[model samples]
Target: MFLPIGQVKKTGLSCHLKWFEQHEILPLYKAGQFPNALCARFIPERPDVLAVAAYDGSKIIGMAGASADTPIMWQIGIDVEKNYRGRGVGTYLVTLLKNEIINRGKLPFYGTSLSNLHSWNIAINSGFIPAWLEVETVEQENYYPCN
Candidate 1:
């Protein structure tokens, strides 16, 4: 899930985002709002540098995170509420986050297993192509298990 930094396009949808940084986002992370974006705990290499959350009144519906995995690239992880599926919330948030990372002078990329169609669609819809797949030697690895 790589969005090539320069190609990030803002969705321009009217999304009201409240930003959060490390430690300040504990409540949301504990609630599992965006587990993929925010790690279970903070660490130096992959700190959750920034997060953009969408809300309905006061309830958070979805979140997109930019985790600094490396000095040159950041990884994006997004999760939308089950009740909000098919509503473009994931796409909107991803687009917003990706562009924001670029603005911050870092390359933003998304990552998810190939089996996750829902997440894959969100990446594609957010204008990120399947940049690369990294694998390691494993015993009986089941590639494309969704099949």
Candidate 2:
């Protein structure tokens, strides 16, 4: 579910959030500094991928982007520079991006490992609540099928 925009907290640090257009996204992608996971899933060439970046003056300090997984579902991801972390960058970016996605008539969701408390906190602080758990298992070649 999408949370109300007014509930999201503003970043403590001085920065501006900008929704990167396709032209801007391409340069960031080519620079090889965008989040690897986001790049792997959301190619810049794809129209379904959208990005919102946090800039501290001329430099990009954080990014929150989403890619459509289905007609209505979009997966969101965030990345913050090491020096800028712990200053509410992640929370601000995700919250801004999430609201933007929702405004576009799509659903945005986040996923993180249980052990990663930092990520979990960012999600919660950004107005995301626990939704569903996901797991993956590999099948052995020698395993027999029971019918």
Candidate 3:
């Protein structure tokens, strides 16, 4: 289940938000500056993957992207450059990306580790609420029931 969150607000940062294009944004991915998740998913092969990047001048400062996990649901991910972090870049990117996804008739969702307060804060600030938790057993054969 997914919980509805509030709308996204404008961020007063002086940066440009642009849709991700393979020829343009692929260099950033190849530069190895982005987080692993961003690098892994920001590919041209998957048309369902979409991204919005925040640029400071000609440099990319942050990115928020989504991958369609299902026909109706998309999973969101984000990364901000170390030097540009904590300045609302993540929140701005996420807000823009989330709104774009919604405008395209899809649901956007986010997930992060419990210990990552920074990510959690970004999610909330960008209009997401705690809705569900995911758990899995990697080694099902080795698991035993305890009574």
Candidate 4:
């Protein structure tokens, strides 16, 4: 999905996910908590930028991340612990991240596997319309399920 640069709303919803800069979130992704699909290297040139994490005290239960696919376009992905699945954590964090991206003057979009209906729903709940399909080649190490 993609959003035209001019359509990013000036104001949007807020939430309690902990925000982190690209540098801060890289280590977490590398720590083996997130799977290969969510690894920062999945799309090397995309440049992971911001991440929002939801926690139960100090334990991270859910996370959503954004990467700059271009100067004005950013893409997002999410990961929620199995125990936390079906809850609203993913949607809230994604929505918060989307709003933050828009507030920062960039367009936010989400692309997910066709079989992953839950993820697609989260994107819709986060206000991302199904603009188009996005396909990209990935290294073997970046396409496996690593968890």
Best by lDDT: 1
lDDT of 2 by residue, 11-93 (tens): 56557768875455656655667662256433544333778888888898888877666768777778889999899888888
CA error at residue 146 for candidate 3, angstroms: 16
TM-scores for all candidates: the values are 0.83, 0.77, 0.77, 0.76
Task: Give the Cα lDDT of each candidate.
Answer: 0.80, 0.72, 0.74, 0.73
Residue pairs with clashing backbones, model 4: none
Pairs with steric clashes in candidate 2? none
Candidate 1, residue 119: the lDDT equals 89
Whole-model lDDT for model 4 versus the true structure? 0.73
Candidate 4 regions with alpha-carbon error over 4 angstroms: 2-16, 36-44, 135-147
Better of 1 and 4 by lDDT: 1
Residues 1-147, candidate 3, lDDT per residue (tens digit)?
Answer: 233384677688778868874455555566665562265535444433677888888888888867667768877888898999899998888888788778878888887877789988888888889998866557677566894
With candidate 1 superimposed using the best TM-score fit, by how many Å does residue 79's alpha carbon deviate from the native? 0.7
Q: Which stretches of candidate 1 lie above 4 Å from their native place?
A: 5-9, 136-147
- True lDDT of residue 125, candidate 2: 88
Residue-level lDDT tens digits of model 1 in 80-140: 8899878888889988888777888888888998688998888888878887986667777
